[model samples]
Target: MISGLGLSTGVAEAEVESRRSGCLWAGTSHSQGAEVIAGGWAFACTADARGVPTWVPGGATSQAGTVPNPGAYTDPQGLFSPGARQPGTSYTDYCVGNQLVEGTNDVYQAVESGGLVFWKAAAPISDWNFDSNSPRPEPTWRSTSNCYRGSLL
Candidate 1:
C-alpha cells in the first residue's frame, strides 16, 4: 500500500506494507531540496558523511594557497601536529603551512597537555626586510586546542 497525504514543500505522509518480507514501514520526510525556514535558519554549509565541513566552489572570497607541511619523515600519526621544526634545518616552519593537519596531515601531540595538538605545514613566509616583498616558502606551524574525538584509520 502507498499513499501521499499532500504536505508543503512537495512532501507527503507516506506508508508502505509488504507481505513478502513480512514488514510494515511508515515515515514522513522532505526532499533535500533547497528551502528556507522561519527566522533565517538554514543549511548554509555542506559536509561529508563524517561531518567534515567543505566549501562550495566560487563561494569563498579568496582561498588560501597550497596547504602547508602535510607531514614529515618522522612523526607518529594522530591529530594535528604544529610548530615542528625540521631537524638540522632552519628554513622550514610547518605551523604556518596551508595544510589541514587534523583532516589529512600529521597530528602532533603535547607531552604535558594531552588535549593540545599542533597543525603544521610548509608556507611562504613574507620578508619585511626585502624591498622585493617576495614571500619565501618556508615551514609554517600553528598550535590549536585539539579535541580529537576519534580517527578513521
Candidate 2:
C-alpha cells in the first residue's frame, strides 16, 4: 500500500502508475519539475490539486528552453463544435495572441507562447452579456460563438 495513496493491493499499483503520468507541455508529456518555453514565455511542469500534471508558466528557467511551433501549441478547440455543447452552455475561455477564444485544441498550447499577440483571459460564455451588449461581437447570437449575443442570461 502506498503511504500517501491508500489503496488495496490490486488498485494501488494502477493508481501509482496514473499519478506519475507528468505534465503535458509543449507537444509532449513531461515529468514534474520539467520546464519548457512556449510562445516566448516561461513554463514549469507542475501538478494541480488533483495531482494531474500541467504546465505552469513562470520566470524563464536557467536553461534557455526551446521554442515550439505556435500552431501546434495554440489551435482553438470547441470554438467550432456546436454539437458538443448547446447555446447556453458554460465554457472555459482561453486567449491566443490577444484574441480570446471559447476553447482550444491544446490546453498546454493556449497556456503559453512568445508571440506579439499574447493571450489574455477571454470572457466566459455565461458572462458575455455584462452591460446590455458584448465586447466581442459575433455574426450571430443565441448560439455558441466567440461572443454569441454577448448577453443572453
- Using lDDT as the measure, the top candidate is 2
Q: Which lDDT tens digits does candidate 2 get at residues 25-44?
A: 32344557765553334667
Q: Positional deviation of 92 in candidate 2, in angstroms? A: 11
**In model 2, which runs have C-alpha deviations exceeding 4 angstroms?**
1-20, 60-67, 72-148, 151-153
Estimated TM-score per prediction?
Answer: 0.15, 0.35
lDDT of 1 by residue, 68-122 (tens): 2222333322321122221111212232233223322222211113433322432
Q: What is the C-alpha RMSD of each candidate to the true structure, in Å?
A: 18.6, 14.4
lDDT of 1 at 15: 20
Worst 10 residues of 2 by lDDT: 78-87
Q: What's model 1's TM-score?
A: 0.15
Q: Candidate 2: deviation at residue 113, Å? A: 22
Q: After superposition, how far is residue 63 of candidate 1 from its true place, in Å?
A: 11
